[model samples]
Target: MNSDWQIELRALRYFICVAEEKSFTRAAGRLRIAQPALSRQIKKLEEDLRVQLFIRNSRGAELTEAGEILLRRAYLIFNQVQQTHHDVTIHSRHLGGVVSVGMPPTPGEFIAPRLLERSKERYPDIELRFVEGFSGELERKLANNEIGVAVMHDPAPRDDIRISKLLVEHLCLVGRSGTLAKPEYSLAEAGSYPLVMPSRPNFLRILIDGHAERLDIPLNIVTRSDGIGHTKSLVKYGHGFTILTYGAVISEVQQGVLQAVPICNPEILWTLCVAMRTDQGRKRTLAVIEELIQEVVQELVAEGIWK
Candidate 1:
C-alpha cells in the first residue's frame, strides 16, 4: 500500500464513464482523452482502492462487485460535491431551479395544483415541472434521473431509491350516484359486483387481484380500462363499479356525480410515499421541495380535502 497515493475526483469520473459506457475505448472518446491515459488513470484508481474495479473481456468492461459498490458511492460523492458548490454560490434565502415531480393521475388530481401554488408562493424563482403517469412510469423516471421526486403508491423496494411514507389511503368502492346500497363493502362483497378496473400490472389492480386471490373471491371484472377517466366514466354511466382511493374521485363524489364507499372487513389500503433516487443527495432546492410536499400533504389531510 502506498501511503502517499490519493485518488482524485477526475479519476472517479473517468472510472464512472468507463463503467457506464462499458468500454474503455468509448469512454476515452467521450472524455476526449487518449485510451492509454484513460487506462493509466483507471489502473491508478484500482491500485489506490486496492480492489479489482472491472473485469476486462472481449465484449466490454464489466464492473466487479467492488466496482458496483464504488459506483453507487461515486454517484453520491458527485451529487454531494455539486450540492456543496450550489450551496456556497447561491443566496441563502432564495433557492431557484426547475424541480421535476411525478405522480399518478389519482393523486395528481388533488396534489398537483396545491403543490404548484405552494411552490410558487414560497420559491418564486423555482419552476415546478410535473410528470403525470402510473407508479411504474414514475419509478422509471426517478431511476433515470428524469424526475427529481415522485409521489408513488405502494412502490416496490429498490436499491437506487429512498422512500418515505406520506400517507395511507383506504380503497373505496366507486360507482354512479345512488348505485351502491351499502355504506361499506367487504372484499368478498366488492368482488361480487361487476367491477370496472385497470388491467393487470397496475399497482391498484395488482393489490385488488392479490387480495381477491387470497380470499378466493372471483371478481366479476366486466371491463378493463387503463385510463382513470375512462374507468370512472364507465362506472358513472352504469357500466360497473370500480375500486379506488377517495381522493381519486373527491370532486365527483362531492358534486353528486359519483359515490365512494369504503371497503371494510379487511380494509384495502395503499401507502403513498415520497420517493427520490439515493444518488440525488438532499440539495437545498430538492430538500425544500420535499419538505413542501410533506407540508402540503399534511395540510390536505388535516383540512379533510384528501382522505
Candidate 2:
C-alpha cells in the first residue's frame, strides 16, 4: 500500500467534476480547462491514491468502487471547507442569523421554551426557529437541509447524516390517573392492554412493536394516531393507554391527569440523539445554537424535567 502521498483540493474538485459529467471532455468544458489537463489531474489523483478511479470506454467514464468511495469523501471535504469559510466570515460580522432546529412533539414541549429563552438572553440578534414533528419527519427535514439540526429518538442509521447520542430515555406506559393500578408493567403486561399508538413507521411505535415481537407478545392496538395531542387526548378520555417516554406526558402526570409507569422486566430504552447532515455547510450561528441545545438538554436532565 502507498502511504506516502499528498493530493490537492484542485485535483479532488476536478475528479468530482469528471465523476459527475462521466466524460473527461464534458468535465473539462464545464471546468473551462483543456481536456488533456483535466485528464492528467485525474490520473495524478488516481496515482496518488493508488487505485483505479474510473473506467473509460466508448461511453465516457464510469466510476469504479474506489471512485464511488472517493466521491463521497470528496463531497464531505468540500462541505467542511465551505463551512469553515462561512464560519470565519460570520465571526467577522455580528453572530446573527436564523437557526432552525427540529424536534419531535414530545421533547419539543419541554425543550423549546428553555432553549428559546437561553438563546435570546445570550444571542439576542440570532433568531431561533423551532419545527415540531415526529422523528421521521424531523429526520427528513434535516436531510433536506430544511432544518439545521434535529433532536431525534432512536434514529435509523444513514450514510449522509451524522448522529450523536444525547441520552438514554426509558419508555413508559401512560394512562389516565388511577387507571394503571401498578407502579411498573412488564413487557407482556403492557402489550396486553388496549393501546392507542401512532401508526407504523413512527419511531416510538417501531420501538414498541419490535419489543413486543421479540417477546412473542401481540400488542392490542385499539386506535392509531399520528398526533401527539390526539393520542394523549384519546388516552385522557379513557380510550386506551399508550407507550411513550416519560417526558412526553410529564405535564399531565404532574397535573394528576395521567400516570406513567416504568416498563420493567427488560425495560425498553431508546437513545435520544442530535442529528445533522454531514454534507451540509454549518454556519457559526448554527454551531452555537447546537451547543445551546446540548446545554439545555443536559440541564433538563439534571433538573429531572426530561426523563
Candidate 3:
C-alpha cells in the first residue's frame, strides 16, 4: 500500500502505448524509442503505482486488471488535457474537439445528420461521432463513458444518470401504404390487428402492454423484433402492423412506402430525453452537443417533422 507517490504523465503514456500495442518492440517502434527504455519506463510506472501493470509472455504484453483500469483513466485524463488546451487556445465560436453521442434507432436516424450538420456549421473544426443502438445498449455505453451523451425513449430511471426530457412523442401505428383503410386506430381496435412489435420490457412494448392491461384489450402480436429496421421492414411487406413514433417512420412515410397513423381513444406518449453520466465532470464540448440536440429536437417538433 504505497500511499504517497507521484507518477508522471509521460510514464502513464508509455504504459498506455505498451498496453495498446501489446508488445514492447512495437510500442518502442511507435514511440520511436529504444525497447529497453520503454521497458524501464513501464517498470518504473508499475513501481510507483505498486501494482503489476502487464503480464509478459511469449505472445505479448497483456494488461492486468490494474493496467486496464489505469488505461481507461489515462485516456480520460489525456482527453481532458487536450480539451483544456483547445479551449484556451481557440476562439469561442471556433471550439474544436471530438464528441461521441449515442441514440436509439428512431431518434438516431433523425438527429445524427442534423446534429452533425449544425456542429459543422458552428464549430467547423469539431468532429462528431454518433453511435446508434437500442436503449439498453446506449445506456451501457453512456455509463461506461464510451459515449458522451445519449438520446432515449422511455429510459429507465438511474441514479447515476441525469436525464433531460426533450419532448413527449405520441405512439402511432405503422403499416404499408394503402394497406390500412384509415389513418387512425383506437387502442381497442388496434388489438384486433396482427401486431408486429418489440418484445416485453422494451420501452414501446411496455407502454403498449400497460395501456392494454388498463383498458382490458388483448393484443394479437404475431411477431416480435427488437430492431427498428426489422420492424419497419416487416410492416412494409405487410407482415404485420407495428407501433412507433412519427419520427421513426418519417423517411418511409414520405417515400410512400409506409403510412404512420396516430393511435388514440387514449393516446400513448413516451418521453424523449437526452442523458449523460452524472458521476463524471461535464465537458464544454458535451454541453454544446447537448444544447444542439435540444435545439434540433425543438426545431423538428415545431416544424411538424418529429410529431
Query: What residue runs in model 3 are displaced by over 4 Å at the alpha carbon?
Result: 1-94
217 Cα displacement, candidate 2 (Å): 0.8
User: What's model 1's TM-score?
Assistant: 0.71
The candidate with the higher lDDT, 1 or 3, is: 1
Across 49-102, the per-residue lDDT of candidate 2 in tens digits comes to: 889999999999999999988887776666566566666786576677667789
lDDT of 3 by residue, 1-307 (tens): 3788765889877987898789999999989999999999988888888899999999999999999988878867766676577657656555667777888877887788899999999878878877788787788767766678899887888998889999998888888998778768998887788999888678778889999999999999999998888889999998999888888899998999998888998899989999987854446677788999999999988888887
Q: Using TM-score as the measure, what is the rank order of every candidate, best first?
A: 1, 3, 2
- Using lDDT as the measure, the top candidate is 1
lDDT by candidate, in order shown: 0.88, 0.85, 0.84
Candidate 2 yields a Cα-based lDDT of: 0.85
Pairs clashing within candidate 3: none
Q: Clashing residue pairs, candidate 2? A: none
How do the residues 1-307 of candidate 1 rate in per-residue lDDT, one tens digit apiece?
Answer: 4588665899999998899789999999999999999999999899887889999999999999999888877766665665676768666776887687898998888788998999999899888978889998899868866678999999999999999999999999998999889989998898889999998789899998998888888999989999999998999999999999999999899999999999997798999999888866656788788888988899999999998
Runs with alpha carbons beyond 4 Å of true place in candidate 2? 1-93
Query: In angstroms, how far off is 143's CA in candidate 1?
Result: 0.8
**Residue-level lDDT for 128 in candidate 1:** 90
Scored against the true structure, residue 57 in model 3 reaches a CA lDDT of 98
In order, how many clashes per candidate?
A: 0, 0, 0
